[model samples]
Target: MIKVGIVGGTGYTGVELLRLLAQHPEANVDVITSRSEAGQAVADMYPNLRGHYDLRFTEPDADRLAACDVVFFATPHGVAHSLAGEILDKGGRVIDLSADFRIRDPELWAKWYGQPHGAPELLKEAVYGLPEVNREKIKQARLIAAPGCYPTAVQLATIPLLEAGLVSADDIIADCKSGVSGAGRGASVGSLLCESSESMMAYAVAGHRHLPEIQQGLEEAAQSDVGLTFVPHLTPMIRGIHATVYTQLLDDAEVDLQTLFEKRYANEPFVDVMPAGSHPATRSVKGVNMCRISIHRPQNGKRVVVLSVIDNLVKGASGQAIQNMNLMFGLPEATGLNQVALMP
Candidate 1:
């Protein structure tokens, strides 16, 4: 069994790791850390994990964590910046579900995250954990930087077009919507049920932190700098992200887009490219680690639209983290992550 240790095991992503790892036949999650919740039983905090984990939360200790085969940092940005190296030094692979090492340029990361990059040195080798794009790299990676919820949906929705050069990368727009859970398990006025229910408002219109990350992935795919306008909206729901992406089709691009998207993700275990006229629903992927995508071109015009959906906390966070762990350890990529999506 692959012994696993988790840092910051109190947030949504943290418990998510616990929930998913519970079903991971080859994984044994023995250590879960939380400075504030130390000594608290994992079951008491999350009833869903009551029958599975008998462990209690403990304060983080690099030596103890490094004893595990792999360490998952479910903490926010900068938390892993301090301890990941120690665990890596102790010979444990690290997969961070934060924005810490996702951005290649440290200065750009600092500019957006409001703090200097803590572990820029590790950036040199940290592989971006999008299995569709970096599967080979992840197998050899000691440090994996998992993409954020929004970036995952947006990039998957647009990258195929960008890579084929069938779309004009000079202008792209992603009008995305996400559940309140995307805000995390924290107490915030914005995430309050009364405040969020019966309302939908777009935030970070000027620019979202995810903008640069999305652009980076698309640019890498297109092999050119991409011009993108991204707008994120907070919805009344609790657990998914729906990304509606728009782009301009190149004048000579007359290939069958449905086949293109289908072929692009045919071998990918998690990305589902729906039928030509399908409009994937976020609920279709709720609680599952899958991205349901569909392609559209209004009136056969030059405009193309891509609709993608994912469970933010799963495919967008912990599920993807586990997926990377599977790759790094040579386990099947879908191990412990084949749960069927929960429906209403």
Candidate 2:
């Protein structure tokens, strides 16, 4: 079994990891750490996992985590900065589901995250863990930085167009909506049920932190600097992200976008390229590790609209983290992640 340790097992992403790993055949949840909820039984906090995990939350101890084969950081952005390096130093692979090591530039990461990066020394060594794009790199990486919820949906939708040189990289718009869970398991006036329900408002329109990560991925696909306007809205649901991306086609040739996306993700296990003209709903991917995408060219015009959806906590965070772990260990990417999407 692949021994596993998780830091910050109290948040939506953390528990999501435990929930998924519980069903994984080759992965074992050896330790899960949380500073505030230390000593509490994992099931007491999350009733859904009551029968699945007997583990308790413990205060993060580097030496304790070092015993595991792999450690996942499902904490807030800077939290992983303090522990990731130590665990890696102990000869265990590390996968961070935070922004700590996702961006290539520490200065840019600090500019958006509002603090000096705690582990700048490890920045150069961290691999961006998007299995569709970096599968080979993840196989050899000792450290992996999983993409955020927003970036995962947006990038998967736009990368194919940008790489095929069929869309305008300079002018791209990613209009995204995410469920309340994306805000995390924290208390906030904005996240309150009364405040968030029956109402949808866009925050971080000026520039979301995920903008740079998305830009970084798109630029890498386009092989040039990219201009993207990413606006995130908080929806009333509990899981998933729906990104409606609009990009003007650069060439007016008879481009087959459906075929383009289908071929682009033909071999990807987690990405589902839906039939042409299909609108992927966020709920279709709720509670599972899947990205459902559809491509369209409106009225055969020079504009393409791509719709992408995924469970933010699954394909966006913890599930993708585990996918990286599977790659790092040479296991089938779908091993512990074959659960079908939960429906209403």
Poorest stretch of ten by lDDT in candidate 1: 85-94
Tell me the tens digit of each residue's lDDT in model 1 across 228-331.
99999999999999999999999899889999999999999999999899999999999999999999999989999999999999999999999999999999
* Candidate 2 lDDT score at position 106: 89
Instruction: Give the backbone clash total of model 2.
Output: 0
Q: Which stretches of candidate 1 lie over 4 Å from their true place?
A: none
Against the correct fold, how does model 1 do in TM-score?
0.99
**Can you give the lDDT of residue 160 in candidate 2?**
90
Per-candidate TM equals: 0.99, 0.98
CA lDDT scores, all candidates in order: 0.95, 0.92
Give the best candidate by lDDT: 1
Q: What are the RMSDs of all candidates, in order?
A: 0.6, 0.9
